[model samples]
Target: MTEGKRAIIQQLLQEYDIQDAQDIQDALKDLLGGTIKEMMESEMDQHLGYEKSERTESEDADRNYRNGYKSKRVNSSYGSMDIDVPQDRHSSFEPKVVKKRQKDISDIDQKIISMYAKGMTTKQISETIDDIYGFEASEGFISDVTDKILPQIEEWQERPLSAVYPIVFIDAIHFSVRDDGVIRKLAAYVVLGINSDGRKEVLSLVIGENESSKYWLSVLNSLKNRGVQDILILCSDGLSGIKEAIQTAFPKTEQQRCIVHMVRNTLKYVANKDMKAFAKDLKTIYTASDEKTALSQLDRVTDKWDGQYPYAMKRWHENWDAISPIFKFSKDVRTAFYTTNAIESLNSTLRRLNRQRSVFPSSQALLKALYLATFEATKKWTSPIRNWGKVRGELSIMYPDRMPD
Candidate 1:
């Protein structure tokens, strides 16, 4: 100990009527015991037998800590703190901080979660813990810490939702995961809401096999059970049974086929040589001033292409009833519903995160990683949603009975 510190310690002890290391030690142990006793009397009754709260569970378990006189030392970033530990009732009291088998510091787990959420590999997290936190936390340890978030993710996924949405966009994207022995594709669907407050919220994520209506039926029904009483606009890229699913869950919601996906799908059928001409003609259909104008423009293009491509016009005409409603709205809202771009943006973020992970040992690990990714992604949802005012205004004029309560 430095002479200056020793002298000051002596001076303070003298003022407090003590001047020896043993006396100081005795005082601290007494103080800590009193603190614990008072705490137990005041609040421990509230959580005596049931599961202890996460913050103090470890603390409650450390009641048997032996009261020791030797100056107990714990190193911290600032340097060292020499404090006494009370061993009395050691089995009944545990401070979460510095508790036995705290395993890793809380900060180490947080750092691992942050890195893993950003798609860092387990090896990377291990190295990061050693470099940044001065501890070697293995990949499994990191996974275990992250696993704490799995139940939270499950709850979030199944949580209740608002009763109504003026606009809802549905889209699914596939991610590769190791299943059994081989890699398999798992589809994740996102439901985005255009709420009365004119903001977009990611309402839910549904994981399923393939994009069939049967799977989507479960997703839609899950939403309904969770409290989504109505939907006003259902936007999606056409998958078989999608329209049927929407009608079954929310009969009044108007469905808008994503023009972006439609345009891309249309291009697939055209020959390389015909794409240039087809693109020019198809532009007219999407740029139409109203549903009538859009249908007329589509008819002209379909009539021209019918002789060259027999089913081209028929496909557009067949889907036109489901596709053209957007043109009647104010152009801003029309543009928003013309595609499921809202969900696409979220999917893009997920893909960017997933491109980093090769495989997960278990579904819980994947869910933990996804939960972190969503947490990171949702922080960016600060901008007022696109054309929300005008969209709600127009919806008010059209669906008089459907505005959010």
Candidate 2:
């Protein structure tokens, strides 16, 4: 078989008047077109219970026989090639390799979909394909390719999840989307979970009108309905009502407000001259040896800067309850959940991809864009979390009941 294939290829190479790579490629396309046509003819012969030239009388006289070939122009990256597909009298023969009405013999749709998933715009994808291959793929064709993933995304959104997640980082990335013919800011809420094996997975993603506790509640409830029984640590930026939402969904889950977000919110009130000193003093509260020491450092921070920026102090005090949970875990485990950095990194990638798209045409368009960006971003999450062995050991001790064997 190998020798036969090599002989056929050698014969094809000899038949082409080789001048450059393009000429060789054209010859190869012709070879493939002929090969495919022959395969379909063989398929028809097998269906009719006889060879192409042999005239045989079978038991079933009503059985369909091979009819003349129907030419089909197939679009491919190699170039436009025509295949003569075999037909039957009853039109019942189905070829497995190239089905009927399948104009894309080269799987160009998958290529377009792959490009779209890599954050390429429809126009960019079309141009890229045209530049590489002498084929015309319109923006609508690109969109249709991407639309095929929507059902897969929908099924993924509704799929069942692990019963428990050791730590979950929830954050929202804002984008401009059109709704009801009006452009508005929309939030894409992402739930990044650390599973038992210490791998990060995007458990759920939901697009909402705005980032609010009310919307987060629905997201959390959706997780609950999808079989997320317990989340030991829920980390998020200091969004109002998130604590209440967590309480309602998983009352036992410990909430850790991102210290980085708190510092940024507090820094808004501090003057430039005092910003460095203020941030230094504020770090003492979150980076202290223990919770009591952190609380004492918090008092000192309030005393030193409260008169100048009372609201900043008030904001810290108001959020202290949510922020204090991080102190309970070991430093190794706490490092993973003390801030929303994990989700923020994902958001940063999304911002880079979407910077060109100022306002999406619709909410569905924005969702599709985000889903594609995320699908591409998560492809690199192959390695396990850094020092996960040590972190998981610490987490096991902290949340013994929730830890898996």
Candidate 3:
């Protein structure tokens, strides 16, 4: 170390009588508190245009002057310490280092927010802060810290989206929230998209009373209002009226029904003994090389199983329009759009995070938790989806007018 720095350290050691690690910590805490106090005093002097105890004509003319100090207990990473905050006669001298009514000078707020995003309960966060920082952080304090993100969430919800999304996945995840002293179930609709540059992004997250096509229509309309001019393909499950909703919002967009969900729904009707054989036949239809071949396979499967399981084959016919769109894309594009797996994977992360809280206190609380979880889950989506180069080429050829250059 430099001689001047070494001399200052030696002076501090003698002044605080440092003997061990705990003593060093205490000395550092005192030093930090004193530093903040000095900074506030300097701020007051700067505001008043003169140093402390210095009498001048300009200072005498001005009415604002130091009015003693207020003892304020502030929390920091080192620990908690009481600092004297400088006050002004006119109450206009606001200390920029520690603003008025601000008690935290540490990064504990950000630490709490990061923990909350990882699905830690407020109480858990309180205990963690106490354990790590040697302070008693109330649950209310933790909630107050996390509540600061509400405005950010609002801005994110209303942010504009790209004019065209080559592939978008829409899905709903349900949670229990308390309303009017009673617990109610609500759905948080998640929309994920692959933009024209072939990178994945979360388009929007909306919390609704329930999963309904009526609500989904509004969600799609919100997307349109946010600058989504066209969507080449939308992948989702067979929620009733969703097809009609998509038609109303973006009629030109091709809707691709999740083939995985369709298979699961179809298997619900097949007998246990015939499930293996039935699923084998059903796979041939969806996995066919082309639309014509898929139809032939569907006809063969229908003739063999229709009499025994009529409803299973009937659903295929009913939703064939939505399911048939996948056959038009190349393998790379088909793999990306054939199912709602992209959004479903995101949903799985949300579900895991939600499991920590059995029931949220309010709809806002539910939204806050989901929004934080979504941010955490999507942190690593910096790159394009697998084989996005080939997928982009295929989409460009398929939607020549919609795809960007």
On lDDT, the leading prediction is: 3
Clashes of each: 18, 0, 0
Superposition error at 385 for model 3 (Å): 1.7
What are the TM-scores, per candidate, against the unseen true structure?
0.76, 0.90, 0.89
In terms of lDDT, the poorest run of 10 residues in model 2 is 207-216
Worst 10 residues of 3 by lDDT: 55-64
What is the C-alpha lDDT profile of model 3 across 33-146, one tens digit per residue? 989899988888899889998965663555777789899998898878899888888888878999888888888888999898877889889999888888999999888889
Write one digit per residue (lDDT tens) for candidate 2, span 1-405: 699999976786788887888888888788788888888878887898788898776767676777888888887768778888888889899997688878787788778877766667788889988888777888988888888888988998999999999889988778888778888887787889988888889998887765567877888999989999999889888766788899988998999888888888889998899999999998888888789998999999899888888888887787788889878766666778888876666888888756767777777767777787788888888877777888888888878777877
How far residue 146's Cα lies from its native spot in candidate 1, in Å, is 1.2
Error of 2 at 338 (Å): 0.3
Total residue pair clashes for candidate 2: 0
lDDT of each: 0.70, 0.83, 0.87
